[model samples]
Target: MTQKVDTAVVLAAGKGKRLDVFETPKPLLKIGGKSLIVHTLDNLKKAGIKNVFIVIRKGDFVQKRELIDYPLNIEFIEQTSGRRGMLDSMLSLEGKIDKPFYVTVSDLILSHNPYKMFVDCGVAGSADTGALVCFDSRQNKESGANTKVLARDGVIREISSRLPSYNALDLGIYYFSPKAHKSICALAKKDKTISSVPQFFVVYSQKEKIRSVEYSGDAWFDVNIPKTFIRAELYLGEENSAESGESKKERTSLKNLPKTVLLHNKKETVTDITVKRNILERLDEYEVIPSESYNSPHHIIVDESIDSFLGKPILDKLLSLGYKVYKHTVKAGENAKSINSYVKLSEEILNKGIDKKSTIISIGGGSVKDMGGFLASTLYRGIGFISIPTTILSQADAAIALKQGVNGGDGKNLIGSWYAPLKIIVDPATILKLDERWVSDGLAECIKQGFAYDKKLYNLLKGYKGDMKDLDFLESVLKLAIEDKVRTIEEDLHEDKIALVNQYGHEFGHAVEHLSGYAYGHGESVAIGMRVSAELSYILGICDRGVVDAHIELLEKYNLPHQVPKVISPEDILNSLKYNKKYYSGEPRFVLVDKIGSVWRDKTYYTVNCRDEFIKQAVEASYN
Candidate 1:
């Protein structure tokens, strides 16, 4: 059984030096359309937190007035020693919270429900003594925050604000039993110079019982700098704007559907002749095909034409390495995703005497990779395949996953396979040659990665100073992007659970792509989808507007589209959503941003059941 917390103490007295807004209290920073304090308050309320004690500076009367009109039940306590810093502010609230309580920073943005964390801590501490929220070490280092904890057999042995080498950082939020609270209070008095919560925790560990509750998902952010400030705003904005009704409908409609594969490829780079050569290379070991005779033979099927340049050179190098090369050229566009194309290519391969022993290499974006992988899977049972993804979309989400398919003319991927690629090679050098529009398209995918799995990636893009076309910068970005995909896929190759996090933008993206008739590239559609997902998550009370806003600002920074085009109707988008691959049993499962690097899939709604009114609102918000 979990212990319920009745009071929450929000530490708001710190004078944020890095934010440079000393004139205004740090908690008052505008995030999305609301103040930071409002976002924090909303999260507490959602978690069933009723009473909140906010510690403020004694002279910050103006800040107090600003928050007086808020809708929640809150008590403001002015700390006489506020200038002494965070530790003193917390100590000031010693006896104000009589019941079990939560302590958190007012400036931190929470993606997960903080109250839930508090409750989990209480439950865990029921047997132990105290529980503190601990986040991943990678996340802490990226944010330049500090945390220290040591545990044994689910019981914290020694918790420190300063450890030799710590893997988890204290999240500045904690659940305290009366006994633990008293111990902390005593530590505060003993260490008068201690300035942070972690330091006090270090002291209490020696005199009282304590344990660390590890938080696995995206839940916390310290918006202490200008960059993080903007990030918080963008995250909140997107959360507040996603389509809720449509997402529910899609989820409900997909409940009874069978899991199937869909394949799509570019027609511009593949032709009947190239297909003929591929078949011949497989069937006749002695026959050799001339690569030069095939038009666009070496042009990889990526989203941008620039990929062809990067791929052609790489193919030449592979050939130089003594590997036999086969070339295929298909016309560019979603129209290439037909049964006719699949059958025609299959017949050509069969005629050429190709068999299961042959290896297939895909060089393109998600479409080409899907088609190529599918063809490889169906030909002669199954064959080895490799993917050389040239677009950011494929590199991050679709590159290494063990799924591929082609969309039928009915606006859905109708045929495919669960074939994993042997390897996926991504070279951002190719992105430098892309047109600005395509670059923006790629940025959408990169941003989606940030939203679903890597806060460092998110912050890197937020602070990016060079041109998007800088090969060096793009290479570095691509490397980081690829690492995120690799990490996720390596942990969950079949997308059983961990990989679901990778779907952060695709739930909404596929619908937008279907409605747009592939006019927009996959990356562009994904950008819009991410924004919609964020908005829906906020409306459903899963996240705050600040998180949504952070997503929007990042999308806007890259000039990615956020709104669906008027040419596509809400009903059309909804209808197209019926084909979402995540649809389970009649419910279209939506992957929403719970916070930066975290995604949630809720199955309560029907697949393809998005309400018309909500879809309209989402489309309208996108334009705004």
Candidate 2:
């Protein structure tokens, strides 16, 4: 049996100089009539903590009266000699704490106990290592980007010092067991002075396994800066009906929270994307199987390569439920996304006797989904289709666009149509099983989406450390990317309406893919294409040189290649772009970004028609 921690240490010594609004200790600042420390203590008590030691600076003894009426067994410790960072604060109780204990910063504002969830995950009981509460850095960029964590399979590989980019930020909440405490102390003893918490963890990870518990709930907020402080005040005030003097304008501020989570009610839309850590747990909601089998039977089109990863579990569930499921495994890869493949797949589905009552389930990457979606649209003049995308690129980019098609002889997606799936189920669990190259392929598309629409989205990718196994982080990224793409598509479902800003890199990306004869994967070409697009925008005097540098910065950050390969000639790329599907008359329209979040829109069309000479120069510049 594993040990359950009952004691905790709260590091509350820091002065609130950065916030500029609070003259008192940051934790003593009142929120909804309760100080931040009071809120933290309440949360610990709720989580069944037995005792808590609050560490403060020497002169901050005046702050003790603030927590005098606290409910838990509270002990106060003053940092007397050589007190430096959080590790020093926690170490002040070295021998006094016998069991594993919870450690959190004092300035965190929470509507719920994240520590409770951390303990429930069995991090304290595990024999391998300890646990740290991590959150998406993309949400609150100020404090979130302070410390970077590199993790794999929920285990921290390294901490402290940014490495190209990182996605999870340590929220300063951790469960350190006796074993970890011993290790951290041993490392600290060798140092001349005290080490910070993240520094200690970085050294400790070299010899031990450290688990990272990613926070998913919406209630967690760190009030370290003025921008976050204002947001926190409004969030807390909105939930507290007990507070009086709330104005109508304050009520309107509630609407500004992420639109998808508006007042906890999802926005109305044509398509729905369900992002979950454990996808199979929510299978029943989609009517995945006919309530009664006498109706139309369902047919499954799965990528054979993923049969072991995602297929077996889903198929097992449907079989256990006693519903008849017919499966057709297609070869996985871009080569499988041909018109011939679509015809053969359609014939197979028809032979299986699938009808309108039966939902067409696609389980694969973009290629597999495209083949299956096209078949679903044409068969019986169209049928219900549900997409279970296995690749990150598919989930983050292709899944929400509702464009289904097969490759024509002239170009990529030349034979596709606008046919949306009834529902999209994104399971990060399956993505964890992909090869790193395949995972990197998805990050490229995710990076493209970031450069085109949302700066936060782009920053998220810039910081993503390729943790295929970090399900919570992946789910958040998928949802963010999906929402961004969905909102863009909804605005211009058909390119005829406006230039699809989401195609920021696809124009040249497709041309490169065609010119290379498919030697480069879709994402690989797109990465290089975006570099060219940014350069072209800069050459045409539409964007600044920094815009070009930002593209290369992100491309190199994700280990994506930006310089066009020597194998593909610039002349070939130009020829291919002319025949590209998105071409009008003879000139191809380009989607260019002037900055991180804004795209340049031409007066006549959503895409600016660039001169051929500028396109050639951009293509030439992309080469090494």
Candidate 3:
């Protein structure tokens, strides 16, 4: 008897778009004398698997009706994630399975039993990888429809159907732990483009690990691939020219760097702003200065709001130092994030002879960072970008973030880049002139972040007695908030669903900001949205009345609005949600917190869908 796993999952939820000629679902297609999924079941039986969960779509009754009498303990899971293919089928098993189990696609037909060795060779006690699978390929011809891989020392470096160069073929079989499932689920939530297993592994290999088991046997082939279909239908595995690919040069993952570069003085302190830091000193320290830039004028992208206090003086100082400088003052508010503003600024900068080798220093707060960083990442393919955050919210948020973009007509920042600046300069003197509202605006973001990940940060904010004028207090908040944010991002370098926790009030908040006709401040809308989220959480019975009260208490402390403006209708906010950038499958997903210190995360879903009735009630309740 083969080794047995008590549980196994069979994925059969694909549309089989290429096999449209056959009226039956691909899993029901007969190979030899049996259906495709039955062949998988027979193999599992031989491997001693007792329980099987087959994932199929909502109306896939034929699969259930056909397998009703199977001896194995079979339960069909209906995939309700809008028919997104194999990826969604896996996600449909969320909270349904908790242990490491065997997995295979229904169309993966095998004549000879490889399951004994597969279950026996399970990966354990390895911190580098939590999942194990096999690889083999007949690399004689251009059979590229199947998943390809490039692995070294039994570790998968790259695996994708779109891989231009690869050495092995994915066996379409896996031993997946709960950790592996979470990685796949998170990538699906954040990025919808990953439909196939290989595409996900390509991204998964970026920060996590995957171990490749050698499978040189001639027993298996996928039915979806046309070339393999003929072999599976006619000869089965009798004539599979299975060959282990030639070993390529061993290359390790040593080139990968941290997505964000947080440079600060190494010494511990209550406030680092008192510690000396400068823009020029950082430029030399990071060596972003190009050889051709000695005579070339470096660009300074400044917002009109700070052009007098900070922008013009910085430009004058550069001129006094005999350094070439080019100052471009963009519109200061939300309008600056408009596509018109971005196009106009780009045209002006290009006309001013900004080249690939030039360094562009971005100054001012949030909108300025959005515009300047987007331009820098796209200009001349890419150029040197230095960030100077001038507000407390942005200081804690940090310009070292990977996402950058300007606004679109339909939504806020619909067009954006998953790119970051080369360096960041933080000088406290820039924030000294900030108005009280600007200070409040900055504090709102830090407060949101604190509630999501760090209770210490929330405690810090709750106990504050002084006004926003306290520089040391501001520095302490920034340090704590930035540290927590960076730690969360480091675990998920792709910033997939894991980082979405920090966006506690963004769903309803973004919609409110858009529908408010630009009259409501970004911070004001977010404050109101936080209240809405808390209300929604209370309605859902996820949190008690105390959590909601504490949420409102903090917002009111900084002169922030906790009640929605009567001018904005709840219906408008509901309709505007689909236009928001984070809309999941056209449904309004809210990130709700059960309490002060943690966000309500359902497995990989940091933001979850809510009924229109509940969302409307929350928004209406917050209205004055």
Which candidate achieves the best TM-score against the true structure?
A: 3
Q: 42-112 in candidate 2: lDDT tens per residue?
A: 88888889799998888776679878877789999886653456767766777887787888888888666
Between candidates 2 and 3, name the one with more favorable lDDT. Answer: 2
- Taking every candidate in turn, the Cα RMSD to the unseen true structure, in Å, is 13.5, 22.2, 18.2
Number of colliding residue pairs in each model: 87, 2, 0
Worst lDDT 10-window in candidate 2: 260-269
Pairing residues by index, what is the TM-score of model 3?
Answer: 0.56
- What would the per-residue lDDT of candidate 3 be over residues 194-254, giving only the tens digit for each residue? 7777778778788777877666455565676333443454444223223121222233334
Q: Which candidate, 1 or 2, would have the higher lDDT against the true structure?
A: 2
Best by lDDT: 2
Q: Output the better candidate (1/2) by TM-score.
A: 2
Q: List model 1 lDDT by residue over 1-624, tens digit each.
A: 455666677888877776653235678876665677887888788787778888887777876798787776888888887545666766777777656777777777766775675455455326334555564665433344555666655456655666776555666767776667776677778867765566666666676556666665564567776445544544554465554356766777776767588566632221111111122113233212233322212212333343356545555655654555555655555554567767776666565555444656666667777877888778777765667665556665566567788887655566777776655555554444457987788777778888877888889899998787776666566667767766776666666566766666677788888777677788888888888777766653456789889988999899888876777776776677677777643435566666787664322221122234444556556655
Superior by lDDT: candidate 1 or candidate 3: 3
Alpha-carbon deviation at 214 in model 1, angstroms: 29
TM-score for every candidate vs. truth? Answer: 0.51, 0.55, 0.56
Q: Give lDDT: candidate 1, residue 391.
A: 58
